[model samples]
Target: MEGDNIEKNRWACRHVLPLYASLGMADEVERIWKVCEYDPRLEECTAAIEAWGKLKKIEEAEAVFDKLEKKLRSPSVKLYSILLKVYAQHKMLAKGKDLVIRMAESGCAIGPLTWDALVKLYIDAGEVEKADSILQRAAEKKSGKPMFSSYVALMDQYAKRGDIHNAEKMFHRMRQVGYASRFRQYESLIQAYINAKAPAYGFRERMKADNLFPNKSMSAQLDQVNAFKKTALSDLLD
Candidate 1:
């Protein structure tokens, strides 16, 4: 009878947990977790943390992480990264930094996910330079490129600050890392140029080369850029 209950709980963790989490039923998730007799899998624990994150329940997320650590005796790097991501989402810079340090001391491999989480933590904390510095250091290592979202995060921040040069630099670097240029990245670069009140020269052609057509929002932005360029040209002609 006990064995049968454990098997049912394992199945519930695999299937029911994610479904409840996605539905924003945090209470139900907690209830299911409490009733489980077997040790939860890493993915199951991650799902609980993510559920709390989506609801912006930082303490709840941390509690789940604590439980995972107690159960496993040593959680995996991915588990640590997911918890770090929850901290990042809530802009808990100090906590995130401390977690990263603990991860290093525990010899958890700082793979792309951990690097990405660290970058995001700094970015959300309004420390763009620090985030970019981490990104550069990560790139110097042989761990391949940081995650695509890391590049996009810096690009979005640079755009928000009207720092067109760095935004463009990030875009190019993202491409150099072999990440296919996507609409979100293109939109961010275009927004950078728009915020700087500068023309995004050859952007349309570049998008064409990537086989990406402008959507409604992007088309509106491009029109503004064209108007700015035309005004500048007319002023020069006069």
Candidate 2:
């Protein structure tokens, strides 16, 4: 074999390093990134950084981020969002929160994913009050539509704590946003009453007055209601 052709590493690194990094081949990623950094293309560097973040390799991701041209890295909103997502998933709450403040200060439009990450971080940190406050701001803030998951997530925390009053309050807030369906209130409202070991007749009557049809998903709640009813009857029998 007397071939004398050589393939340049630039093209291969630009196109394939991200894939290798994503597939968890850290060594190959480092090798390719070393060559690719000489050219400093935004697309390639972004891919490499994203791959590192996807793999949860914080140091590697940071290295790629640093290797990006200063201008290429400075105003990149997508890159910030990606990094914030990784930060949230990895429990790097402080960094994620700092990035959020920075994004807001820089006027980089915060999207739903970033907001979701912040809320999740608060919830996971046992700062349910903060999470609720964020949901409140989301509802009241003119910047973006309130995320339904935010509402449900806060309601979940309240329900878990057997907080019927706040859970009902959240139900009212959800209704104010036109999420007044009977189904939406089951986990958010009825479950609170059930967990609190309190009768839900008032809520049932309210639903009846609202003319909520008994959808199929209501069957289990109906069964729960009947079970509670039998317990009451048995108590009176005693």
Candidate 3:
């Protein structure tokens, strides 16, 4: 069992836990995971956790985390972040937030990327105010660059609520932080304006170039928006 080829196989196995998750082979993944737990390598544990998370096996992933506590000296921040990400993926925002706080209290520095995951989850949940609070807290930190993507997300949320003032604030923040104002960002705001029956700048050309013909529902919505405006399709095109 302790031969060179066996050694090579073991080393190779160390790398495949992530692969199993990517390939979505949950049973094969668990088989490899059990072997890693018995042998107990740090990299293996990390990979196993990630594999489980990717497969959306949150309970199994948490089980591995629980099992590893006795064997590893202390888990790395990367490992904890992965676990937080699993919670977020499952829409368990409160659980994810609690994990971050616990990890911080235990002196593990959960970074901005970790916070961003929770912000995304809150946004998906339509809890825009909560997402804003999380972004504000993360910004208050001394470290990390400005999260431009967070502002874009906030812009989308504000647009959904038809809060143009707040959406504009986020758009300015994105500009201040040097984020390229992407087309989807514009679409969200335009959609908000259309829904609110308000005048939206650059509406027609953006729609035509966006190749939005496939969506019948959206096309009908656009017709309604078009009715209120004085400008024609040609005007928008021009």
Question: In the order shown, what is each candidate's alpha-carbon RMSD?
Answer: 3.4, 6.2, 6.4
Q: Could you tell me the TM-score of candidate 3?
A: 0.69
**Residue 5 lDDT (model 1):** 70
Clashes of 1: 0
lDDT (Cα) of model 1 = 0.85
| Candidate 3 residue lDDT tens string, 1-238 | 2235533567655577788789989987877766567666767777777888889988888888777765664667777777876776778877777877877776876566766776777887668888888777777776574466667778777877778777767766665545666655665666666656666555556645654432565556566667646455546888
- Report how far residue 206 has shifted in candidate 2, in Å: 5.7
Q: What global local distance difference test value does model 3 have?
A: 0.70
Residue lDDT tens for model 1, 138-175: 98888657899899999999999889999989998887
lDDT of each: 0.85, 0.71, 0.70
User: How would you encode candidate 2's per-residue C-alpha lDDT over 136-221 as one tens digit per residue?
Assistant: 77767666766677778888888888798999888788889777555666656777767776666655567777776556666576
Please give each candidate's TM-score. Answer: 0.86, 0.65, 0.69
Q: Of the pair 1 and 3, which is ahead by lDDT?
A: 1
